[model samples]
Target chain A: MSEVFIFATLNGLVTGLLLFMLASGLTLIFSMMGVLNFAHASFYMLGAYFAYTISGVIGFWGGLLFAPLIVGAIGAIVERYGLRRVHASGHVAELVFTFGLAFLIEELVQFFWGRDTKNYQSPEIFDFALFSLFGQEFSAYRGFMIFIAIAIFAGLYVVLTRSRVGIIIQAAISHPNTVANLGHNVPFIFMCVFGTGTALAGIAGVIAGPVLTTFPGMATVLGSIVFIIVVIGGLGSLPGALIASLLVGLLQSYAIASDVGMPELLTLLGISFDRNHPLNDLWTLNLPQIAPVLPYLLLVLVLIFKPTGLMGNREE
Target chain B: MTMLKVSNLHAFYDKSHILQGVNFHVNAGEIVSLLGRNGVGRSTTVKTIMGEVEPKGSIEFKGEEIAGLKPFQIAHRGLGYVPENRDIFPTLTVRQNLILGLKGKEENGRWTIDDMFSMFPNLATRADVPGGVLSGGEQQMLCMCRTLMGDPELIMIDEPTEGLAPKVVEQIAVLLQEIASRGVSILLVEQKLSIALKISQRLYVMGHGKVVYEGTPSSLLEAHDVRAEWLEV
Candidate 1:
C-alpha cells in the first residue's frame, strides 16, 4: 500500500530478473563444460565499458547491439585458446585460469576506463517518468529494463528449447560423441555456447550499467551475488535461475525496505540489552544492513544440504 | 588383405609391461579370436589396438599406421572398439548413446541403426531410457550397437560375453558370427573358449603378453597338449 514498499518491490524485481540473465548463462556453461567460469562477470563489465565507449559514437541502441557482439567474440577466443589448452591439465587448473582472467579483466578495465564510474546515461527517449505509483514517480527506464530482461529470457528459452541449434547444444552436453557422430563439431559447438553465454552476461551489464553504476568494481560487487543466484537456483536449470533470482531480489528488497532489527524484536519479546554490553553490536543487528549477504548464506546452506543445487542433477 | 596388423607389440599401464612382443594379424571380413586365460593381456591387446594405450611397436589398419593416433582419430579412421566396461554415457538415452558412436564416416557399412535395431530389438524397445538403467547384457548390446553405428571397417570387441547370462552370451556369439558373415572384420577378445570357437575362423592364445598359440578352432580343440601347454587350462 505504501509508495516506498511498492517502489522497493518493483526495483527488487528488476534487479532479480537481471541477475537471472547472468546466472542462467553461467549455469548452462558450467553444466556443459564442468567449469565454473570466474571471469563471467568480467565479461559483463566489458559489455558496460564497450557500451559506454560506443554510446558516444553510434548512440545507445547501437552500442547495446555491438558491445555484446565484440565481447562474445572475445569469449569464443578465450575458450579456444585459454580454456581448451588448460582442459587437459584438469578442471581445477581451468577454474584457476578463469579466476586469473577475472583479475586481469579488472586491471584492464582500470587501465582503459580509469578507477571512476563512467557517465552511462539512460537513452533520451526513455528519460521521462512513466507513471505515479502509490504517489511516487516510476521511471520509464526501469520499466524498459524489465521489458528487455523478459524479452531476452523468452528469446533464450525459445532458442534453447525449440530451435535445431538448441537441440544440438543439449545433445552435446549429454552425448557429445553422438552429436559428433551425426556430423557436428563438438568443440566448435562448445565454443559457440560459451560465447553466447558470455554475450548474454555482457548484454545484462550493458542494460544495468547505468542503473547499477558502471565502475571498475561493478564486476566485483555483482560477481559473487550472481554465483549465489545461480547455485541457489539450481545449476543448469534456466527456470530455476529465474525463480531464485526473483526470490533473492524480492527478499533483499523487502528486507532493506522494511524497518526491522534485533533490538526491535528484543523489545517486543520483553528483553533488553545494556548499551555497555559486550554483545551490543549483535543486539543492534538489522536485516537491511545484512540484506546483501542473504543470497550467499542461502548458497552455503544449499551447498551443505543439497549439493546438486535446488533443481540440478548431481555433480553436473 | 589384412585389415589389422600388429608386430612385436608391447604396451604398459605405467612401468609394468602388459602386452609383450605380441605379433598378430586379422584379415578383412575375418573373425580372429584372441583366446587366453585371465591376466594374459587379452583386454590390453584390444586397448592398444584402439589407441587407448600407448603400445610399443607398429600397428597398421587398412595400410595406415595407427599405433599413436588419438581415440577419436582412430575411430574416425574406421577402427571401432567396444571397451570391456561398455563405457556407455550413463545419463544419455539409449538412442543418444548409440548416436554418439555413429561418427558419420560409414559411407557404405553393412550396419545401420535400423539394421542394428532389427538385429537387437531389445535396444529399440528401451530407446528412451538412460543407458545406466539397462541390464548388463542390454548394456553390452547398446555398446555393440553404438560401435556399429560408427560403421567401422574393422571392429575390436573386448570380452563382449564376459559377464553375461549363458543365453545372452549365446545370442551375442550369434550376433558376432552374423556380423562377421556380412564382411566386417572383427578381432574378438573372449575368455569363453566355447563362444570364441563358435564364431572365430582362427584363434591366437597369449601367455605373458606374447602369442604362443595360433590355429583353427577345431585344431585348437583337438590339440590337448597345445591347450594344456600354451593355453594351460
Candidate 2:
C-alpha cells in the first residue's frame, strides 16, 4: 500500500508538471491578448499529430526537433492573419474564433489522420527502464519527459527574463506602445510570442501523446483541464502554474490511490444507508470513482475563494 | 519646410466627432504646443497622428502620408508618441522598457539608453525596477525616455505635466527644453499654458477639433480671449 502511494505520487507529479507546460503558454497568451485561448489544447493535439507524422518519416528524435517548428509556424500565421484581424471586434470574438478553431482542428485531424488512434509509441532508444525504486521500474521515456519539461521550463524562464528578445516580449505585454517607440516591431513580437507559446504546447503534446493516447478526442480530453490548471494557479503567473499543476496532480493521485470512500465516512459517522434508498448510488461512490472530478472541484473552490488564482495579480 | 503637416484631419470615437477638421503644421527643430480644455480632442488628435485611432484626414511626416498607418508602422517611420497615460510596461524594468523602443533597424540611431539615462538620472538608479513601481514624476520621465529610445524625428508628448508636483513640472519643462534643443521637433500637448509657453517656440490653441489660433508663444500669451475661451482649464 505504501509503495503504491509513493509511486502514484511520483507519477502524479510528472503528470502535473507536464500540464503546467501547456498552462504556462496559455497564461502568457491570455495576459498579452487578454483572451483565454479556447483552442490551446487543440494546438497540443496538433503538435502530437505533427510529431506522429514526422516521426514516421524522420524518426522520433527528428520529429521532436521539427514538429514544434511546424506547429509554431502555423500558430504565427494564424495569429497574424486571423487573430489580428479579429482583435478589433473584442475579446468575445477572439475567444469564439479560438473555440471554432479548436473544433475545426479536431475535424482536420480526423480527416488527415483518419479517425483512428495513431500508434505514437515512445522512441526505441528510451524503451528501457532508467531505474527501479522499491521493486518498481521507472520507464526511460517517462524519465526523459521529466528532463525535457524541466529543461524547457528553464529555457523559457531564461528567454522571458534574461535575453533581449524576452525583455521586449515582456514589455510588449504591458506597454506595446512604449516598445514600438523604442524602434521595436511590436506586432512582429506578438506574432513570435504567440507562435512560441503554441509551439511549446505542441512539444508537450508530442511527448505526452504516446502515454496519454493520441486520437481525435485527445484535444477534447485535456483542453479544459489545462485551462483549469492555469486558472487555479492564477492567470499569467508562471510559478503559480507550476505550483498548481503539482497540487492537482498530488491531490488526484492520492484520491486514486486511497481506498477510502463515502462508505468509510458513513461507517465512521454511524450512518446506515438502505439499498432501497434513492440516494444509494451516491452513498456507495468510491474514492477512485471520484478522482477524475477532483481537478474541477478544486478549480471551482479556487474560483470561489481566490479569483486571482494562487499567484495571479489580475482577476479574470 | 514643415516636418509634419496635418490637413483637414477629422476623427471620431464611436459616433462622437472628437476631432472636427483639424489642421496643423510643425517645422523642424521647433517645440509646438497644442493647448485645449478637457474633452476638446487634444489627446484624440495625438492618437490620430500616431495611427492609434482611425482618423479621416491626411497626416504627412517626412513628406509621406501616414494617417492610415498603424501605431507600430508610424513608430517604424521615425515617429514617436508618448500617450496621455504614459502606458509604461508594468512587468518590464526601466532598461527593458527603454530598449523596447530601439527595435527599428534604421541607420540614423539617434537616441540610446545612455542618452535617456543621462537626461533622467532618477531612471538610471531604477533601471532594474519595473515601471509600475515608479512615482508619477519618475513614470513620466521613463515614458519620455522610452520614446526617446526610438530616435524619432518627431515626438508627440500628450500632457507631459498634467498631474505632478510643481518641482516635477519644472523638471519636465527643463527636459522638454533640452529635448527641443537636440534638433527633434516636439509636439507638446499641454493644459498648463505657463509651462507650454516657457518651452514651446510655437503654440496652437484648439477648440472643437479645429486649430482656433496659431502663433509664436508670445502671441498666444498676448491673446487673452483665446486662452479664456479655449484653454481655461
> Where does model 2 exceed 4 Å of error?
A176-183, A272-278, B104-108
For candidate 2, write residues B133-227 as lDDT tens digits. 99999999998887877778899999989789999999998888888888889999987787888888888888887899989888877888887
Best-fitting candidate, scored by TM-score: 2
Q: How would the docking of model 1 be graded? A: incorrect
Predicted candidate 2 versus true structure: per-residue lDDT over A78-165, tens digit per residue:
8999999999999899999999999999999999998989999889899898888899988989888888888878887898888878
Question: Would you give me the overall lDDT of model 2?
Answer: 0.86
List TM-score per model, in order: 0.86, 0.94
| Cα error of candidate 2 at position A170, Å | 2.7
After the best TM-score superposition of candidate 2, give how far the Cα of residue B193 lies from its true spot, in angstroms: 1.4
Number of the top-ranking candidate, with lDDT as the measure: 2
Candidate 1 — which pairs collide? A177-B100, A178-B99, A178-B100, A181-B102, A181-B103
Tell me the interface RMSD of model 2, in angstroms.
2.5
